[model samples]
Target: MVEAARALFVREGYHATTLTAVADRAEVGHRTVYVRFGTKAALLRHVVDVAVAGDTAERAVAERDWYRAALTGRTLADRIEALAEGTAGLMERAADLFEVVLQAQATEPELAEAFQAGRADTRGLLRRFVESARTDGLLAETTDPAWQEETVALAGQAETYLLLRRTTGWAPEQYGAWLRRTLTHVLAAPLR
Candidate 1:
């Protein structure tokens, strides 16, 4: 049902997608969708969550290998590179659906809340990375950890990836490399 809804939402969009259509696509009863998801907004939220997490409900973003590499990297540059690669993969998979959700936010209160919640979650993850960098003495003495965290969070956003990939025709690899280099320059301490 989630797969069905995701495909429909991507092809037909949020406003045009109906519960009956989702049921038909999934080959399930209408009542099954209603009973499982309760509402279209709830179903959309599930779709977004699954997409952002790369189609797995079992593991979280932090548990992913790429994210783990970022957290466990030997230096801030390595960490930023790993983070950029991971974020590029995520944006490639979820950018379209995220745009759909963003568009629906004005009309759907639940989706609006979900969008904000997702941003907060991203911020929290960046904060953890910033704290780790500070602990490892990878940050410059003059660097403001809070400001760096916010900058990383904003730089890692899906919209930036979408813009570069979609509007500028950059491949995912190119985008990832650029992101890694840009973030390293922006967030890393000066080399001795």
Candidate 2:
């Protein structure tokens, strides 16, 4: 049933996905879906959670490892490749559910809370990573607000990859490579 709802939610945004459609997709009765999930919003949230499937936390760890490597003067290319690989894997797994989650946040306040909570957790984890890097003298100082913004903006690269996937149907590795190249360019230290 969760898979069915996830499919419908991805095919047609959260506002349009209905219990009846999910029921049809799942080959179950509408009453059964409602009994199992309670509400459309609840069902959608469950589907999103299933789609996320613990990847967010794993991705956070990957990001920390990549950034820590960068601090050691490792080539930005290598770090970007690592970051892109981790992001691409997670994005591919959660793309459909992520679409539904975005739609749900746009349309439902209750579901938005869950989405916001996830966002906050990611930001908090990033904050910890940056703090550690600062203490290790990898970053000049953590006082700058832009340090936090940069961490959050990494999602922009993932969003761009999603757009390219929809338009060009590129393989995951191809997209990851492109993201790595772009990130390397953007993240390289300023010249003296």
Candidate 3:
């Protein structure tokens, strides 16, 4: 049901997608869709949650292995690769849905709230990462943590990913490489 809604939401914009359509796609009763997920906004949020987490597991993204690798990979470059690859994997799975959220946020309060909440979650995780990296001398010691966090956030953002994908026609793997190269060059790590 979540997958069906995700497909419909991405193929057809959020406003254009309906509970009935989701029900039909999922081959479930119309009431089942409503009873399962009260509103379209709620359903969309659920879909995003599943995509972001890569599953409906009740675990936070910070608990995920890839995210952990970003924090504790063998080397600075390895950590950077983990960050790039993890972000690329996430965007590949949900960038379209994120674009859908971006479009729908303008008029939908629920979606706007959800979108902001998601951003906050990303920033919070990034803040911790930058702090840890700085402490470990993986990032420039003199650089501001806020700057580092925001820079990484901007690079890993859906808007940036979508824009680059649209203009350069780069595939996900290509984007991941670009991210790795950009991070390695743009963020100078201090000598360990």
Instruction: Please report, in order, the local distance difference test score of every candidate based on alpha carbons.
Output: 0.82, 0.63, 0.85
Per residue, candidate 2 scores C-alpha lDDT tens digits across 30-76 of 89998998899899777766555543243443245544553343443
- Over the stretch 1-192, how does candidate 3's per-residue lDDT look in tens digits? 998999999999998999999999999999999998999999999999899888889998899998898888767788888888888898889888999999899888999998888777887776676666767877765435566677777777677888998999988889999989877765675423
Who is ahead in TM-score, 1 or 3? 3
After superposition on all CA atoms, what RMSD does each candidate show versus the true structure?
2.3, 5.0, 2.3
Best prediction by lDDT: 3
**Residue 176 error for model 3, in Å?**
1.0
The C-alpha local distance difference test score for the whole of candidate 2 amounts to 0.63
lDDT by residue (tens digit), candidate 1, 105-139 = 99999999988888788878877877777788887
**Model 3 misplaced regions, further than 4 Å:** 143-145, 189-192
lDDT of 1: 0.82
Error of 2 at 191 (Å): 7.7
Error of 1 at 89 (Å): 1.2
Specify the highest-TM-score model's number.
Answer: 3
For model 1, the run of ten residues with the poorest summed lDDT: 183-192
Error of 1 at 122 (Å): 0.7
